[model samples]
Target: MISKRHADILKILDSSGTVTVAELANLLGVSTETVRRDLRPLVEDGAVHRMHGAVSLTGPTAEAPFRRRMRENAPAKQAIAARVAATILDGQTVMLDTGTTTSFIARALTGHRRLRVVTNSMDVARTLAVTGGNRVFLTAGEVRPDSGAALGPAAVAHVLQFRADVAVISAGGVDALAVTDYDPDEAEFARALLTCAPRRVVATDATKFGRRGLVAVVGFDGMDELVTDAAPPAVIASAMAAGGARLVLAG
Candidate 1:
């Protein structure tokens, strides 16, 4: 049987994706040694993965589900979202792809007015459609149960039909070479969004820095800007500079 403490730890991991040992110890009102003891069984069961001083649901290769991803690095995501939203004009047309960060961007945009939003994310559509007198176009295609994102060729075709002022996308991982995603269909969809707009922005938290992803969405040359809560590592920063992409750090 899972102990109450173990269950609580799982809950925190489920929501936060990763937490430091010190933070967990503080939250649990226990010593670091006690937290380590509780984590051992969970790690053995493959319920969580341990790092040097922290724990996460698993390695970056396995993408977390949408709800969990939304909760993960939430404050940083919100800050990035706000920063991106501020750069957008009140009445500009925007193309957005499906991802947790982009969902936060949609929410941050609720205060703006007369915006035309194009997206494959049901979460983005529902958030922006009723507020701000925005016209939201939800792409048509098969929806993924985990993300509620429309995917496949039909969705790509739907996105290509509109021209927008800006395109904002979230990535699963971002290495020096490219912005990437775990799902091939979503990566293809993001590529389409990039083409539909002149200004292409990638919104991701710092956790994605230097992480490897399964599918390449776009090379840095194809990106206009990167919005995040922290500075990227040297390799990534150099790549962004070489590609002429601006890196905006959010508070």
Candidate 2:
């Protein structure tokens, strides 16, 4: 489904055939950033082709980046973290992927002790380290400077060697029916973790609602549960259900 802003912009263009980002932003009383962001999904969806600062949707649609596309949805992220934390069993081995949403899980896990954490996330490992009283194993791999997470052939291999009771993976995007990521290595790492671990969970905010991008990380069919802020829209809810995921609505 097209975003409200995207739809509105498209409506205005039916009469003129095209509009610039600046004009759309000014007309909509929103930032150019917002306008550009709205256009990106259309470009990815092939609904509209973006030319310079302008966009036009003719047919179909492309995927949008979930994690990076929507960074400001803090409330949804926190709620998802709370739900993810609630799923942990005492002393259960858990693996968390590298993402801001997963970091919130680390914070929520502060009170838990003696839990085994297998992770490639420097921030997550550091958080557990300072918290004290946890059996955390840092994965051996190359760290991606931007995400501050370890990933590589070694990381994938290392993650695959372990078996955990639970694993929480995050992503950069999702479509009407698939889960995906923008970084190929991150996708590979997450998939490897899911493969080795038994019970799998996905943590994502609402902004990841409806889009697919880059590469497929894990299909919806693979997740045992999906922890999100609330019951998402009809499309998202249906997709997760179709995959047989126990949808956990947090907060």
Candidate 3:
């Protein structure tokens, strides 16, 4: 499903460099009532820039394009990416998921001499291809235009054929028992990916720390490690740790 918020954010960023509530409403074909509701959290989270009557991403008034939203918090995401990169050992068969955070890790891994990366994300695959010298494995299936990852039953079956040393996935949110995502196909595809990889690592930022998105990709008990920008809510973090999952705060 195409979320109105997602569609609006991406649309506004694409047409105008940055936009205000009024401008966004016009660009996104929505009402000011709906525009303000969508812009509130994005502005607060620093994902978008806001001003009296205009908004943009480059300057104080600019907002990040949807595709680059997660890259905005360089310090926090780099901290998280560093730890994720450190976890990769030479010659390990790793599974990388789609997300800005994971994409950062893919670029950070320049030192690893020998390793195979199996991923459904075109961006991650292309980024790693730049660093040079690693076996990059792309799964077989249809790509999802909405989420920027490979999906469909064929993709799930292809992932099941291999056992990864570690699978690093990005989440839209984290709840008590499950990982969350905006789209059901992406969530289901993620579930199948996790089942194929015995050791699972979740790569998410502080913004996704406690929210529950549309679907549960997997539960806390299913993870081997949870890597984030900050310490997750103590109670939830502890519960995850108790499940034998290591909870590491990068930022």
Best by TM-score: 1
Predicted candidate 3 versus true structure: per-residue lDDT over 1-251, tens digit per residue:
22667656855675545344555666677787877777676668766665444455533444334454544566777888898888788888888877777877887776786778888888778876655477888887888663367877877788778888888888867866677876566677778878867788888887666666667887777888888877778777777877778888774
Off by over 4 Å in 2: 1-71
Stretches off by above 4 angstroms in model 3 are 1-66, 130-132
- State the lDDT of candidate 1 residue by residue for 1-251, as single tens digits: 33999999988877666566767888899998999999999899888877546677754554555666787789999999999999999999999899989999999999999999999999999999999889999999899876799999999999999999999999878899999776789999999999989999999999989766678999989989999999999999999999999999998
lDDT, candidate 2, 169-247, per-residue tens: 9866666667777668888898888887779888887666664556788877888887877567788778778888777
Off by over 4 Å in 1: 1-64
Cα deviation at 165, candidate 3, in Å, is: 0.9
What number of backbone clashes does candidate 3 have, counting pairs of residues 3 or more apart or in separate chains? 7
**CA shift of 132, model 3, Å:** 4.5
Residue 157, model 3: Cα distance from true site in angstroms: 1.5
Q: What are the lDDT figures for the candidates, one per model?
A: 0.89, 0.75, 0.73
Which ten-residue region of model 1 has the weakest summed lDDT? Answer: 58-67
All-Cα superposition RMSD per candidate:
7.3, 9.6, 8.3
